[model samples]
Target: MWRLRDKYAIAGVGYTAFSARSSVTVRDLALEACGGAMADAGLMPADIDGVVSFHFNDSVPAMAVATGLGLPGARYAIDYQAGGNAANLIVQTAAMAIEAGLATNILCYRAMNGRSGFRLGGGRELAAHGVTQYTAPYGWISYPQAMAMWCRRHMIEYGTTSEQLGAVAVTCRRNAALNDRAMQRQPITLDDHQASRMIVEPFHLLDICLETDGACAVLVTSAERARDLARTPVYIMGAAYGGGPNQGDDLFDAMRWPDHSHNYARYIADDLWASAGIGPDDVDVAEIYDCFTYSVIMQLEGLGFCAPGEGGAFVQAGRIDRDGALPVNTHGGLLSEAYIHGLNHVVEAVEQLRGQAGARQVDGAEIALTTAGAMTCGGAMVLRN
Candidate 1:
């Protein structure tokens, strides 16, 4: 097992109150959340010496560290990735930085005003990519539509139903109702979900995630120092990531994948379990990304939560509710929570492990896991108090 697994803990997790406007620019937004996280951990900006950020992050950490919250030049700065998978990558990078003794304190974050700033319509750059140029122009317009094609294909092959899909949306919406920070606090029933208009053949608008402008940051410190901090310290037991294999975008590979050409979560899940020596059954809650409702269902199978075909039945049985055996996306998730591009899910998972999730707290949640998408990108982490 990697020593970093138990060497570092997430001493602090922070986010600006998620909003469409945030009443602040992207840089100020990051500073607010990063400040909150530092205060929560009983530290000041000067305490940090290493930073990890996305290549496209509007609110650069080292810049923030210098301007408002000053830190001397960082010992290490990583622009390793910029995708939904950023949350996990940040944690992993922080652990490595700490393990190498490059810095005693590591900060990782993401901030965006993309929502109040820009509509979720096709970017000029994306128009040239396959999600639009090839697949979308051929009628796969939105992500929900693209995902619905995959979900419908699964249903055709495995007999999944609309109710099963609706259950995923309902559970996430209900989870939102339990969370004050959730943007969409309103709850929905099976009938409400079913009655919702279809954006895609099998997906309703309710199945899609909200676009919001905000920022989230996490503080990583030595596990021992974390234990001495102000609040619960959720230990990063393990973290790992993977993307499905690809050569060219061949028809045979497409046939094998149909969804995305690979099983990212399955690979990452195996990585986490092997490194942490813990299996899926040991996890108490899941904060897997919900960019689309069906993504959660697909992750259930890929992450070993249930058998491939049993995913629909698994969710439909209320097994993912707060009281259920394995509650998931308990902080409303990206679907209902403001999607600061999926960073909030990481914060929520840490909160769940720390027993600070307030109204949405899972009982005795000692272990939690989460994932984010990067093309077919996926990653998992095991956290425990």
Candidate 2:
């Protein structure tokens, strides 16, 4: 099979200030981010030939961004109907398109007013459809409730404690304290995590991710071209997207699923590493998705950082802290950082590999791994400088 490793690179990354409310429209937010990415790459808007973005029916289309950025008849433009799970997959798609000779410079982005409008926690009534029809009437209306079931299952099956989950939240906030752009920079203790009001039974208010109005974007191009760009070229070492058994079915239908204790990470880990020609230990830093605290522990187990049933203990031991064996979410992550879906995670990985992450920078960082989503279908990627 053909390999994508080292063939493409993330030439540039950019983000707008994250906030609870924005004075501008989501389209304006996307334009600012895309323009910033282009400028960072030392490219003009006319040089871009492709545009890609993902949203949960909350943002504008790729063409709208392309036109707003003044791209001259974009060659390839698409908007995936997805959420955080597609974060890595969209970059992979852009790179594949570049390799296929479809587009040269593609801008992949995610922009949303997750806090000011269209909250993921069910700010508005959703039409009854798919498994939601069966689950919604029973009060399973938001993502937190659906994810809480999986968290509870992990606790029951592996004796995971709320304190262990608290470790993840506390660590994220600690990292966010060093990130000027993070929404929640105040450090919190495990006791604070425990004392915070519960949003769902297994998730405290601090355990959940922050919803912010913001946009993040990256520029994708061939490695050869990226070498001549403005910043250090972070090559795409590998990428994988898909899920395990019954993944094609409605993911929220936990009743029909086989294992609630695990997630998509395990199924994709082998392929992700094999394609990258590295293992978990080879990774210098990681940006695992943390939509919720337990999601981080679950991905840690599934991504081969630790054996099954060891994730709770792994986190409790501080293996994911800034000074741990493998520093993770150095940009504060979704829990404390602004949630641009998971696209900001990818941006953070690029910065780490480029040696651009200032104080939180992992010493001599070379290879970086980033994962998006946990319980449902997800994707992951490896990057290297």
TM-score of 2: 0.98
lDDT of 1 by residue, 43-126 (tens): 876787776766343455455544566776678766654557566877888888888889887777778775777544333354
- How do the predictions measure up, each by TM-score? 0.91, 0.98
Alpha carbon lDDT of each predicted model: 0.76, 0.90
The digit string of per-residue lDDT tens for model 2 on 1-385 reads 2289999999989899999999799999999999999999999988999999998889999999999998987999998998788999899999989999999999999999888987878733567776667777777878888899999999999999999999999999999998889999999999999999988898899889999999999999999999999999999998898777776445456575679999889888888989999899999999999999999999989989999899999999988888999888999999998899899999999888888888878889999999998776889999999
- Top-lDDT candidate index: 2
RMSD of 1: 3.0
Q: Among these predicted structures, which one has the highest TM-score?
A: 2
Clashes of each: 1, 0
What residue runs in model 1 are displaced by over 4 Å at the alpha carbon?
A: 1-3, 55-62, 125-133, 136-141, 247-262
- For candidate 1, the 10 contiguous residues with the lowest summed lDDT are 247-256
